[model samples]
Target: MEALIPTPADCEVRSVIKIFNAQSIVPIEIHRQLCRVYGPNVMSKQMVCRWCRQFSAGRQSVHDEKRNGQPSIITDDLVELVREHIMENHRVTIAELSSHVPQISCSLLHEIVMEHLLFRKLCARWVPKQLTPEHKTNAGIVFLHDNARPHTAQRTASLLQEFSWEVFNHPPYSPDLAPSDFHLFLHLKKFLSGERQHFENDREAEMVVTQWFQSQAADFYDTGIQKLVPRYDKCLNFGWDYVEK
Candidate 1:
């Protein structure tokens, strides 16, 4: 059975152990469950016990800790090489970059790009900055929000009037027309879920969310806002009924 079945990575096995351990499953039971699916050679009982103990002690990451004597893949020359590739084509993907620099893993490459070089993906393209100048100015910016209590409050109305900003009328309970509800929140939820992020405090969560927003390209926001036109048309044509996607 072990010969026919392909082996899973150590990290993969660790992830399974972590999940089961979180549910208070004993190490022996976890190993038994894993053996049933991945064959007996999946992991040793002792290994499962060790990981369960680690998680119980508050270890969050599944990846192995960096061990001494392992040579670092990231070097000045490699950093320069990555920089050259990004400079040549800002749209280059991690997969494409890996083909050019096959010596390093994609995860390591991502670390180099994000942490070492301070580059991030914006609208599917790697960029150094958000590159949205329109945000720097409030000129011709139309503010649109729902008629929530706080939003429709006298203070809010006075603030908008004070700024001389054009406030677009939004009907009640019209989430379809709200860019945040229909678009931003959807992507935000996916990003949060995919990362399985656990924040220690509100500050950490806020920092992560702010970084996410800053990483987005101008076109990402523009695209979301642009959809409001068609959405508005739909709402009006449907006699202001709930616009279901």
Candidate 2:
């Protein structure tokens, strides 16, 4: 038989209180002992004192008493409503959702969006917990390239036009304004530095780079892309001169 590893119980704090109270230790001393073992965050001082009082009053059970009021109800309809709101506006905040669905509490609405719907806030938008292959393929591509011979070639322009991609004009000799130069390469360079050895071939190098890109959170690309607006503004402010960092 495999050995069973003991996991910390949900009522561990209360159990500790019960044990120490039986030993006639004061609440403050009990709290100090708990802090020494479990750190201060395990339970607050006020909670320790409250539990100590409960034990003194002949309360044998460490389990919480059943309350009289109604529990917070989370319906399927409420979950659907939250989903609709999010789909309508991906950048909708929890507070905005609350205004749309005033019946549910903000906390409950958040639970519906995150736990039930499996969506997380990324780049100021509620995105899926995992990006599907379809999601990646469907994402809009905003192409930006410098005025190199190959990039500025007629064939390249024709290909971009065929794909219907919106190309941002890259000012000549302004690598500072390029997101790949200023942001992406800086991080990519650091990542390459930590490699164990040089890649065997171009294929291996491409695989490694693709894996690194996929491993990054959805917000990573968004952050790099969003920097362009501010960078352009700064570049214009500086009269098209090299925009200092």
Q: Choose the strongest candidate by TM-score.
A: 1
Q: Identify the runs in model 2 with alpha carbons over 4 angstroms from their true place.
A: 1-141
lDDT of 1 by residue, 123-193 (tens): 34565532233224312445888888998999999999999886776766565788887889889999999
Question: In model 1, what lDDT does residue 134 have?
Answer: 24
Candidate 1 structure, TM-score to reference: 0.43
lDDT of 2 by residue, 1-245 (tens): 22132334537768988999999999889988877776655555555766777788899887655546885476433565677678678889999999999987899888888887788764366766655443455445558887889989999999999999857666675658777877788788889997754989999999999889889896787677667666766776676678656
Which residue pairs of candidate 2 clash?
none
Strongest candidate by lDDT:
1
Give the range where candidate 2 is weakest over 10 consecutive residues by summed lDDT: 1-10
Clashes of 1: 0
